[model samples]
Target: MSPRPSDRRSFLKTSVATAAAVSVPYIFTSQDARADEQKSSESNDRPLVGCIGTGSRWNAVGPNAMQLGDVVAVCDVDANHANGAKKKVTDIQSKKGVQRDVDVYEDYQKILDRNDIEIVTIVTTDHWHSKIAIEAMKAGKDVYCEKPLTLTIDEGKKICQVAKETGRVFQVGTQQRSEMGLKFLQAIALIQAGRIGDVQHVAVAIGGSPTSNSIPVVDVPSGLNWEKWLGQAPLVDYRWAKEGKQTKTRCHYEFRWWYEYSGGKLTDWGAHHVDIAQWGIGQNGDGQGASSIEPIYAKHPVEFKDGMPLQDDRYNCATNFHVKATFDNGVVMDIKDSHQDELGFNNGIMFTGTKGRFLVNRGKIVGAPIDELKDNPLPENAIAEVYGGKDPARSNAHMANFFECVKTRKLPISDVFTHHRALTTCHLSNIAIRLNRSLKWDPKSEQILGDDQANAMQSREARKGYEVTV
Candidate 1:
């Protein structure tokens, strides 16, 4: 028998209240909880999964759903996106002779209310990551959130805390961690094995930051809940122009170039590259952050004062910028864009060591001065040992890892604590470029030491009613 409407509401309220009582933690477990998870997977008829932020990445997640579990719900601010994912899941289920139906919703909260969902895949923008992941965890659902982890440094810390408290499996969507033969894995292994001969400096080059451009307001499309889409952000009219209606303004994917919505290319790509830098440098936890950040050069599309906009113009971020970060361990990480020649590799992480230097991006890895390392090879089991030696071809491995941990009440590999440290580097770069000055950072306190202006950039005031709380 179907549950009465009142009964369903009562159940949802109780579940949310119970989830809120859990407290997040600072540490996480690295072991796989497959033994416990296997029992649950076998006992249950099938796990019902939900997806939030159904964007382009949905294409990749579709096949994984068929093999892993049932996609019971899909939610997106855009109706088109929500419907698109719903169709995909239904079509796949139909082919398999599964009589299950996938529901669609414009608001993600609707999905959270359904007790049938065991997991949620989050592919929202950077800003929405923490909010949705935290709420989902509280609702007792395991989370598979896309990379760069948190939108802000504070959000990163909060996510870690929430995951620990809820005992929900949370995995950051940095798929390169699951990719085999990548330079990032190889570089870290070499450094750990002392093949790098006391690593001192590393160079990481990502793309540009946002600009100070104010686009004219446009009509919000039918089916798009613009207000809900702007959750946690100030309510503003949709400034994006329709297709073929080109203006001097940018929106959507171009939203990455705005301070309110994103941290430009630094966060967009840095989430991947800078993450690799953090792993190699061994700075993946609390009290483990960069000590200093300096913006050597920046060419902004508009003027600014210590990261604040001076003019309400078209763009608000830097068009070109170079930043240098010094860790307490005396390691210097230089992040810049190489205009000299494109570097052949536009976006990736590069590590330079005393022994040699290696560059790693998606599906590609190359090295220089390889003769010495080629002769003196790394340990046969180094890479596997670092990443727990898991198979790369396992579909949705990162998400699967999170689910395994959820059943055992263990933390996934890309837990919030480690991810926060990585995001700190990315955020600092954006802040430095905006301020266009050198700033001292106190990694121990997670604040900008001695500089009030720099410290203020750590977090922003959430729009009145959209504030996120513990």
Candidate 2:
């Protein structure tokens, strides 16, 4: 039955109200109404979005952003990336007959300063994630940041706190949480329904961190601001080349392999795999992370501190290491390599429960025991319920989720507090590798129990002028 406009509005109001009463910590607040009204009053008549970091992911995100509202501005440290995105947005808008034009910027803060921009899509390298996101939220713009939510544990917590204080809608880019075929819904339902009979262990396999390879320092390409590209990270010689003489910019994807810019594969792939592990284990927001963690022997030989790599060149993160994280519920999450012949890439996770084990990744979900459960029948709208019944195919749905919360003041599904707990697990793995020893952790306090060195690793010194304040 088609509902009346007033009826639909009433339903939305009631849904939002009911959502608020559910005691979800991530709920949006009243400020969203003010923002909405302000947006309506502005003659722009479009939800202006700024893209920060226009590399690979932005290609997917830019078109989606345009469909959602308007890509008014695009920011990238590299001129090529910035101009590329701007041209793409222009082409899409032109083809669609949407007369909107987008401006390009090297500094994201300039985009933040504009009142017209209501949302910022952050697809920068891992290191810049928290710094720019926190600042954008503080600037009164809703943030849609890529995962792993933060580069460090402390950064994750700070982001959570700032979102709470500012009442801005923040969505972490963990699309698996929204992907229907992943059987994320099935897994969550089974776990929540006790179908797995109390999950005792979760096994996640992610790729190893990049190895340190010497690249000669190169000259900084023309039309690119090399210093600004470094952002908050330490200034390093372009490794393979010197400044000014460089033929190409050190801006974009290659930065992932360097410690100064990224956490290598640990933060790269671990962000996705570990996030699933955390979700399946039901550790989100104010929940304890892995109670204790230890590193498993690396199949490939690598230098170690405690169990972490000691070298700072090429790759500073571990290439091969298994971290055992024990949850408070006696659940052990083993983040390790998949048995080569048996599991191949081991790019997914295996959840072991009293009933049996189930494996899931982007493309597949398999289990001998749960095989019967698959055809047994899934509840109607089971997948939709996981996404709060939103369209899963929508690329900007996560951003839409944030915007909806901005107006309704409801917590996003991927709120900061919840993501913080998940990030704790990621950080623990890094710490275990760095320390090269098993360590006790207090998940409740989010600290390394009685270990000064481990505790110190929680936060790092932010580069000058780029420090984040909670």
Candidate 3:
């Protein structure tokens, strides 16, 4: 059976009231969209979508778009990936007895140049997230960018500014926000409801970043735009390798290990865990973040000078570290590679409060307080409430939210402003480790107080012809 009317209203009231009190512009309402727009699903008048960056992660989201709407264009710096994605979209439509002609391109801007596409999915590498997202907003398309939202702290401000100026729907792909029964939102609900008393400390345990030795340079593979792949990043020769055949250390999944293109595990898993941690603590929206950040310990595979890696051959991000941050309200947070010894958990958040504590992860939720809720669990309307009254068991809930918001002009649950705020903490953690020092952050000013060198690292110089601007 579905939830009752009163139960639905009560569930929405929790998040909606909090959103309203803070004046979040895109909170859901009964009149969120025109009645005619809601009928698009029945009439098959779905939005046109374009997929950019059809890498492995992109594979997860590409098919979901096909389920919701027509994917007419696919783009990627790697020709093989782009063409492969186009074929996938074409096949999906054919199976539905619909003939489609999906176009393929290497330059993403070509897809943006088309005025007919209404939505764009950006699953590019971390460094390219903000620039492409900003440009897409300027092109008047609703965007679904995967996390972490920005490569540096400065990119966060640019993304938020452009999103507001355009008034378009911008959703960050943090699926944990919508996964029903994951206990992420449930944890937030309990904290907001005071079931855990005032949250004293939150421990986030994301695993250590990968380490790699210097890789020998190799020739660029055919059908790949090596120059475009390195867009905005300093030009470096390709390092081609495969398992036994040719082990290329800098391509595909290995990109996460390098600081030049991504922030390693700090932004990888940290994006998901840290984002949830901040949300539960009531500090994820605009102008909300830690007041101070301290890098207690760190280790790296390469040397560093002035916060930049000195070597060009090996993975350079911190392999292991612990960062401590304090909020303005005196809430303390510990972000580390693991907490197995300290808390008997390694890949989840441990929220310690005055009355009780609990641990939450993808696998399970465990603790005395949660155990006490044997039969008296979260209300039946909780899933719908957290999802803005939509079905919680949706196979593509995160992408579904983005598509609905595109038509309604309402904010997706994982809005850009909040994602940027959460990502800011992750970026700061990387910076603190690179600098090997503590930092005083002024959340109001969004500045690293009294530290000129650290503040300078907030942004990097984009390569010529690829500079990102607001």
lDDT of each: 0.69, 0.70, 0.80
- Shift in Å, residue 44, candidate 3: 4.4
Cα-based lDDT at residue 51, candidate 1: 86
Tens-digit lDDT track of model 2 for 1-470: 12345534543443443334322221112345436535553865557788898989888767766776777778876677788888898899778776555677777877898787788999887888988998999999988888777777889878878888898888888767766464665677666666677788888887775443434434444444555666676554333332354322234666765545666566777777777778777776475677888887543234664434444334455567777888887888877755363655558878889978788888777786457766765566665676666655555566667667766778877777777787778777777776777788887777788888888888878768888786
Q: Which lDDT tens digits does candidate 3 get at residues 1-470?
A: 12245534543443343333233221111233223233433466778788889998988888887788877778887777887887888788789865556777777887798766788999988888888999999999999888888889999999989999999899888889888465687777667666678899999999997665567556455566655677888766566444455354766777888888889888998889999999888888677899999999999998888888777766787888999999987789999998855466678888888878899998877787788678657677764675677765757878887888887899898998888888889998899999999999887789999999999989989989999999
Instruction: Enumerate residue pairs that collide in model 3.
Output: 241-246, 241-247, 241-248, 242-246, 242-247, 242-248
Cα distance off (Å), candidate 2, residue 412: 2.2
**Cα error, candidate 3, residue 42 (Å):** 14
lDDT (Cα, tens digit) per residue for candidate 1, span 328-369: 878888877643334545566666677766676776667763
Question: What does candidate 3 score on TM?
Answer: 0.88
Please give the clash total of every predicted structure, in order: 16, 31, 6
**Which residue segments of model 1 deviate by more than 4 Å?**
1-46, 62-66, 209-214, 242-251, 310-313, 339-345, 368-376, 393-395
Off-target runs (Cα >4 Å) in candidate 2 are: 1-45, 180-182, 240-251, 298-313, 340-345, 389-396
**Cα lDDT of model 1 overall?**
0.69
Model 3 residue 397 lDDT score: 79
